[model samples]
Target: MLLLKWSAMGDVVIATALFEDIAQAFPGREIHLNTLPVWEGLFVEDSRFSSVFAVDLRARQGQMQRIVEWLQRVRAGHYDLVIDLQCNDRSRLLLSLLWLVGCHIPYRLGNRRQFPYNIAPAELPKPVHTMTRCRAALEAGGISATTPRPVLSLPQFNHARVDRLMKAHELREGHYAVFMPGCNAKGYLKRWGAARYAALANRFHEDGLVRIVLIGGADEVDECQAIAETCGEWLVNLCGQTEIFDIPLLCQPARLIVANDTGGAHLASVSTTPMLVICGPTDPRRVKPLGDNVVTLQADLPCINCYRKTCSHHSCMSMLTPDRVWQRVQKLVQEAA
Candidate 1:
């Protein structure tokens, strides 16, 4: 059996739990996964996967070689079952090539009406979130309906690294709040302004008693740096420093995490860390992280859920002030206390 899912980091994080669901549905059958090179690190070491193969669509020559090699395995192994969780143009092309090579895969499962899929989502529900839709597809197509929690295991090397970061920054465990101020970096509309973040960081440092930590990727270095400077010595800027998988471990000690709709928020979904997700252009109903202690703050604009990256007005995010978020922050902290 082969399971295919090669997408964004957040999507992959959300799908991590569904491996257990598939494993439960098809017991005793070896489950092989096809994912990107970056994500190979997550499932290659995992016991759930019998084998893990990397598929880098970005690299042309490497992708062609891997495709040829994988087709050979498909022909030799005679894998009849292929679950196309990605259900995109890439997976469709792979299936088409397999047919061209005379690899007769008997059972093809997917959510869309693409060719070669014998099983697919049958009358799936609407208004459900993105991950929930994936779950529904699994249930409708005979996979077990159990909702497994997303899990990301940290490597042994990261513990010492995180310890050093804490020591260098003088951060105490469970006494700090993490702020993720950067969005996808492709657009300015998706983020709550860094000015707002600076205000919140300064406010939290002064009154909330919890230390403030500004964390983001290289794309957000400038934003994190400006915010860190504005918030003074109390706020530490660790943007572009920590790895994506290490965010969960960092969040483990966080009193609370406040983030714009970003990858770190999705990475933190596996942990019990309380998170406040600020959503604007993208709909939270479709992509917010699935976790026990997560809350979303969205502007009450009419065009809030519009997925457009570039907007002229941009009030969907600009109107959603820091004070509004701070109110919710206070409420979440009190409820947790």
Candidate 2:
């Protein structure tokens, strides 16, 4: 069996829910995952997959050659089943290429009602959450999909690293809040502002959650730094200091995770910790992190969920005040306590 889900680290984290389901459905059969190079660390040590293939199909140079080579490798593997969870144009093209090369695989499951998919759900409605669509696709492919929650396996090395960081700061488990203050460059509009985050940190501190842990990639260093500088010694800015796999482990002991709608928020959902994902231009219904303890806060506006790249007013985010977010956080923190 071969599962294909490419870029966007958040979607990759959501797709991890299906790994165990696929493994159980096809016991003894080797399950292989094909993803981008950056996400290979997520599944390289996972026991569910026999092999993890990393390819950059979205590269500007040699993209076609890369796809052709990937197709060649797939053809050689002679996979019996191909699960296209991505359901994007590129993944559809990959499925079409299999037919073009006469590489026939028995089962090709996809979420959409499109060609090259021999198996698919009868009606996968649009505007649905990505995780729901993934579940439907698996069910259509005859997998029970009993496990619906996102999960990650923590490495002992990451465990030790997190322990050292927490000890250095004298932070206790389930006493600190994790903040993901930045998103990918393309989703800058989704940010709920660094000043608001700093205010929230102060509020959390006053309310007894003194230690605030800021986690993000290199793109978020400036944003995290701004929050740390404003919030003072309480904020531990671990931005760019940890790998993707370390997110879940760090989040495991956190009392609360407050974040913008970003990939790190989704990665942190693997932990059972209470998380609050602030939404702006993006719709929480379609993109919010998945977990029983996770909740989303979006301002009510006619222009909400506009999905706009460039906006004139930008009220979707600007109007979402820190006081409103703090109210929601109080509930999460109180409940978790």
Candidate with top lDDT is 2
lDDT per residue (tens digit) for residues 1-337 in model 1: 9888888888888888787788778888898888888888876457777888875666756867877876776666678788887877877888878888888799888776558677777655566676776776786677775654577667777778888898888888777998899966885577888899998887777775557888888789988887877777778888999986678878888888999888778887777777899988888888788776888999898898888868888888778777888889889877877
Over 133-194, each residue of candidate 2 has an lDDT whose tens digit, in order, gives: 88888898789977746867778888888888889887798789899999987878998888
Worst 10 residues of 2 by lDDT: 145-154
TM-score of each: 0.90, 0.95
Q: Which ten residues in a row have the lowest lDDT in candidate 1?
A: 145-154
lDDT of 1 at 180: 90
**Cα lDDT listed for each candidate:** 0.80, 0.86
Candidate 1 all-Cα RMSD:
2.4
Error of 1 at 201 (Å): 1.2
